[model samples]
Target: MTKSDFPALRMTIDGGRLVPAGPFDAERLNSYRRGTVVYVRFTEEKDRVLVRKWFAIIDIVLKQCQTPWKNRDQAHEAIKLALGIVNLSKTVGGDYMQYPKSITALEDPELQEALEQMTELLSRMTGVDVATLKKETAHIVEYEDHGPTTGEIIEHESGAASPDADEPPSSSSAGAAESPSSAAPTNTDTTETPVADLVSVETSGDGDAPTPSPGARDPETQRLIDFAKDVLPLAANTETTGSLLSAIEKEWAPEIKKMSADGQEKAKAISRSMRAIFNRQASLNGALDFFSDALGCSVEELGG
Candidate 1:
């Protein structure tokens, strides 16, 4: 019989035998054939709770911000894109495509990493303090035990659960949770110099590209340079590149406003480095030239 003929069953695997956990139709149990293979799905309540908390955090952030995204799914995709939590592939037409992995499927370590990244982005976007947000959202996941004990039994031949199936449908969109892949599949090609790898670049000793002198080294500038290198590659491939830049710019504005003239000049230099790195991925020289022109200083100033 087809899977549809079998009744839904919730059971435990005890010593290689299926032990029904609760009331199940006895009539349907007889339908099982000897040696017939049945599929099983194990559910992790902790993971489910974490997913709930993630959506809750997104809901709070979306409610407080004026973002291009209209709903949590869109916001989730945007955050993943900006943070580089996605896979890349090319279409037949040679356009790039991003497949943002569903957070529900992430392993524990990856899920923690995603939580950290999402929290950082949400804080930057909404001006909400990360500590406060974390404290407020921590208790938001109220677990319900109404469902089949921790694991559920199934009769499916093969395949996996839909990414969209993990969460309930949102009011912003009907039916079911929107999958990340549901977004536009095509993207403009952004292949250029790989920005992250350039952090290790050594000066060739030729006048072609000058290395920063040790005397010019400033801890703060070095920190910004390292930050810029980490995120620039992720930003370049996203259609919301402007959005990422705008968020960082927003974060920098107030700090810039409070600086003294000299401090403001230094802040401007730092800002130039950020903008240059984000705007031009064409060549190393192009990015450096933009930084130098904007800073109106020697290339070595990038280190300070």
Candidate 2:
């Protein structure tokens, strides 16, 4: 029988028995045999937006579930990512406040199955054992405030340590003290160094006297590291190399173009830099290297 021919399924909500509110459009009904519910068609604009948002949420959740580090922390991170996508899709879909309520109201088995699939996808993406994901979901439902904030959890997973504001400095701080004359110069001065000079410096000393990594170098490395840090948050939320590349392309397009004789070279340089950064070739150092190679200039020159 066709969707219109099939009788509308009845469901209860808020202690009231509610029948399917809208006309059953066959084309819109996606039926899942496992759950005898039929997903409704998007007749209203709000419903349409909800569908779009839900789709995006599902996509992100699925991707995260498939990630290799499946755990409560990872699940928490995935939820945060899904929530962010939900927020953005809400804006794109045009009904931000109504989403939660509408999602709660959906009774179609097909829709339920979709959500289930999303959860499963999340489990897979995160590399969390299925049993573990289920247990964590239940725990999250029970706990009120244990859930970590998106920023906190994501930063942790990304290898950034949270600053403990309440804790006092450790005794080691006493030994680490340096006189003003010995103190390092401001970041601005360091970031302006030429790429050639940056490459010339050894990133490390002998094993006994280890030195700071590339990120600890002068201002140019520091600046790029800062830029990479900002991009991590954005990347976790949406597609593309976080959003830095997009911003740079838009904001610096004119300046970048003016630098090259025909602008094509500048465009190529920007593209190369983006690929290197997003691919995680070698962290911020690699990004700088890519830029230097593209521009045929030293890192010091770029900084200057």
lDDT of each: 0.47, 0.34
> Runs in model 1 with CA error above 4 Å?
1-47, 93-96, 141-304
Give the TM-score (vs. native) of candidate 1. 0.41
Residue-by-residue lDDT tens digits, candidate 1, 1-304: 6756444554545798777555553345556787887676664333354665577567654443333456877777655544445565678998655566677777668777667656654553344556755754544333222334323332111124434434533534432222222222434432221111122323244523243543564544444444344334434443547777668767767755764553454454334434433443132333333333222234444332
Name the lDDT value of residue 117 in candidate 2: 42
Residue runs of model 2 more than 4 Å from their true location after superposition: 1-241, 259-263, 281-283, 293-304
Candidate 2 backbone overlaps, count: 26
- TM-score of every model versus the real structure: 0.41, 0.19
| Model 2 CA lDDT for position 274 | 46
Mark the 10 consecutive residues where model 1 has the least summed lDDT. Answer: 190-199
RMSD of each: 17.6, 20.7
Top candidate on lDDT is 1
Clashes (backbone N, CA, C under 3 Å), per candidate, total 0, 26
